[model samples]
Target: MDFVHRKLEPPDLQDCAPQGTKVTDTDPRMIYHGEMIPVGTPDVAQGLKDARRALRTNRFRPTGRRKSMIIDGCAGKTTLLLQIGRAYQGLLETERRPDSEWTPVVYINVPPRRESNLDWSLPFADFFGMDHTINIDKRTYRSTDMTEPVAHAMRESRTSLILIDGIDRIHDSELTTAFDYFDCLQDRLRVSVIYCGRGAIDIVNEGLHNRRRSDRPGASEQFRSSLPVMWIRPIPFQKGQEEGWRTVLQSYDDNLRLYNHQPGALLELDEELHERTRGYMDTLDQLICQTAQQAIEDETEAITKEALDDMRVGRNEPDDDWA
Candidate 1:
């Protein structure tokens, strides 16, 4: 027992033996968060090609315009959405659009922990090049008061895009209610809404559609026409999924070389290290970064199976069962 451990009133992993320390999980990085990714067709390159075509053809409206699209998927929806949003923002800045035409973007995570009712109008202020402050605290907002304001804002903007991630976490009842607001708002606005989630938004839209189909004329058909839903099928992690993975693995080819570099270099367990992480981009990233830190503390030459295994699947040494 050293003074560092003895003197500290509160104990942590510092008290544990070197071997007991854990830096990261080598567990399966096959987790699929709600990311915006190119919906690779059935996880194949050609599938992606076809999906892109569908997005351009079937999803596009006259004048090459399109209503908001919902990219629904259970895995990697947020990552995918951010990627697309990033690309779109870059293009918006780079390419030439009419000075008068404004298609601002809104990226939000509608989690179970988020404000139940959101004010969509307030969020897009910055995107549209407006200097308005709405919903200053993201963590504390409830969306209940947003429908009217959001609908009004959408109608005002010439063209707009809304990218909402993690909406599935919001309850069906709330979502349906929200759909009513968005639908009514969409009726007033020609906005193209994009929703990214773990699964499909059809059920949500269906409920919203059903609500109006009973008494309204062509209401259900109109609702379907208003917002079209699309799914971003899983793209197989080919050579680590994206092309960037190839560069990553190539740089870390010599597993032993990792030890020579900065401490916490993830050991190249296999020549196809990048290949192994394909389709699990987000998960593998987390695993590699975390394991690297642990390797440094352990003074290991390279990331070992023991370390990765500990991260992915627990070693579960021992713990006193509390009553």
Candidate 2:
């Protein structure tokens, strides 16, 4: 992902942005550094454009901002947030010098699996030297309450970019609690967030059970209007769209030798690979990365079509869904 993300350098290109319908390599804002089109399709380019613009303008908000995003190809939403935080942090460093005015872009990853009794609203407390001195008696400083710690962290670091990854992974029972935490932080903090992962279904509808009706019944517009939900597909190679995709994969092959021993070999099995992956970004990445390991184990220089066919057949055997 780092290799893919570095490409988003600056300049300013007309096309290729998530929204740009007609993209050219001209005046591109160095944004394409290391980053490959998750799914080399035209549909997602528009969403990418919107996301990039929002990030630049600090418009990714909750109630008024784009609250949700449906990212494709990548796994581990928390890790991706960390990466975005690092990128924004670097950008902040470049844009604002030490003496200049700028707040630290705090990256907070909340895993629903780790439901500690401690207050979750101000999770950054641990990151900003508040979680030290693990003492039952003196830990809860009146000044360092749930919200104060976050405010202090923001003031001390002087940042407005607050990234909170993983909103859908929480336990079913804690969904409302998590929303409360999210609502509190979003409403009180003066920062923007990149809420990654499967955004709530509400993101498409308006607010909560808020629904609407035109010719047909539909959810409220607030849900759809608030957060810009962009769905990223896996990089694909249509019947004739193989060259560009091959270039992208070969680059991957070159970087991960163990994975791409057959740098030029994937083209041969493109048919079968496409059939199984069906252009899903995450699954495709997993397939190729895994195949690279398989190649090393099988002592083969190239991934054979027979191997893929066998794997596909086995993958579809009875009870395959259980697997």
Candidate 3:
């Protein structure tokens, strides 16, 4: 079967009044709430730009350099990764043929392994709908190495970018083999790769440790001392730093579908929102999305301080005092 990667589509939301959106007996607004509304927060926007630049530069290169994006806290790395992927895909939509099966990008979440052995190629095979498993018995199976076929499929599909997420979940013992597979993929496919996770820096460092240096004269001098890295840290709520936080809140406000919500409602409570979410995008997203959904159900049609305070979402760390 030919696997055509579907582009990540944002929900087609109606203007602000989610209560009025009728898809079935259930409110269609629930679908919107289920998605992570892409906000162009400062860090996210910068990350997107860097990722795009890397992909564009490596589009026609014989070998692509690896890039890494590290998140200081584990709040929203996956969301940022998706945003970057979606943005890059959007850029290619104009150039992609109408009937083309060309999947310019591939996304994989590194699965947590119980043992040191992992079939790194399985993810790619799964993405492209290739059979990478061999039947061991009537009820048992083993994954066959699909690296070569996977690489060929990627090249055939004209895939230029690969996004690897959840690298932190990979066991330390498996890091060498995991990155080795990636290095092979990049060398063979000549595709731009963005490694993302909290431990992304370490992963990149390990991969670069034994990387083959070009034998061309002056190549060592031309090589970068460090891999390209982007950090996605939380927006601070301090005086000067507060603007980014406010901007993010304002984005949620703009996208919210509350009928009675006044303009700048969320912006006015930026400080409180920051205090509640500690400027963490994940927590902030959960808080706002849940609150908006609640307001809709309650017919309040507005986000209030009490409603915000009452909403409980996100993990509660021991040091967390945001309650």
Candidate 4:
């Protein structure tokens, strides 16, 4: 999975068809809808810049302010993290020796909370493809605490960065142990960690505050002091942000595979798109991609305002005005 992930790149406009050209291939056109469109929004651009600097400064440092980053937002957090990861992996491929087994970056989602004692190292073990369980007998097996072995694997692989998504899903009670595991990884492995999720700042700050109160030394003082956070919010429709928002729409417009879409069709609906999606990037994507698919199904082969209006997949219900 790591190998496949490293090989995967964000979908490109060339993956489908040139603008104003017909996209008759059913599979490719449909596949484009599910692809994460890599619009170079300011937030994403800034994230890449920060991630590069963190990876560079944290290199070979044994301790002190590893410069970890937390990307916090209600939306686009995971997408931005994945984008950074892909870019990081691409750069690693060029520097790595052909014989090296190093997997410089590890990306994993925070696993769901468990009823029993959660082995916080499980996600890392899974990422490294290590067995986290030991066979006690022919028909019996026990879960092995893989904290040491997973760290060993990371050391062997020479992993420099770890990208963790879905930090918000961890229950408050589980934060200490999970973060303790992470703290250990950073301190022992000397790896820079980047985390992503909604409300991540409050969640992590509260965890650190609780740890401080309890006098646990696991949450490193460096992490508490030097962790930099970048918030990724939806582009607002207000003045001064109009160009950015329209540029995003222009990117989508430029990539649409619809046969009859005009060059500036989506750009013209920037305001209406914002109104429909309330500036949520994911919802805006859903509106355009789903409407494009609907157009293809109905043989229109082009997105129209009427088709967009018929789609009701926003995160919130439409207001009475839109309804």
Number of the top-ranking candidate, with lDDT as the measure? 4
Model 1 residue 61 lDDT score: 58
**Candidate 3 structure quality by residue, lDDT tens digits, 119-180:** 78788888888887778767898777777888888998888778888776766566667777
lDDT ranking, best first? 4, 3, 2, 1
Q: After superposing candidate 2, which stretches have Cα over 4 Å from the reference?
A: 1-48, 59-83, 96-103, 113-118, 132-145, 170-180, 199-223, 235-248, 258-262, 307-323
lDDT by residue for model 1 (1-323), tens: 01111221211223423443333333111111111112222323332343344444532455533455555654555645655554444445465553444445556555443332344344444344453433646655333334454445545544445566666665544555566655655555544456666543554555456542233344323445345555544234345554444434333322222232443243344333333343354455455545555555565635655676556512121132323
Candidate 4 lDDT score at position 170: 74
Candidates' TM-scores?
0.52, 0.60, 0.81, 0.83
Clashing residue pairs for model 4: none
TM-score of 4: 0.83
Give the range of the ten consecutive residues with the poorest summed lDDT in model 2: 27-36
* Poorest lDDT segment (10 consecutive residues) of candidate 3: 212-221
For candidate 4, the per-residue lDDT at 311 reads 88
Q: Over the stretch 1-323, how does candidate 4's per-residue lDDT look in tens digits? A: 24424432434446655554544536566666655355677788888898887777777565684767888875788877887777777777788663346777889888775323336778778887787777776788767677787888889888878898988887767777777777778888888788788767656666555543234434333345336887687887787768878888888888776667789999888767888888788888888878887776666878777887888976654453655
Mark the regions of model 4 whose C-alpha exceeds 4 Å error after superposition.
Answer: 1-26, 60-65, 98-100, 114-118, 136-141, 211-226, 316-323
lDDT of 3: 0.69
Q: Rate residue 82 of model 2 by lDDT.
A: 53
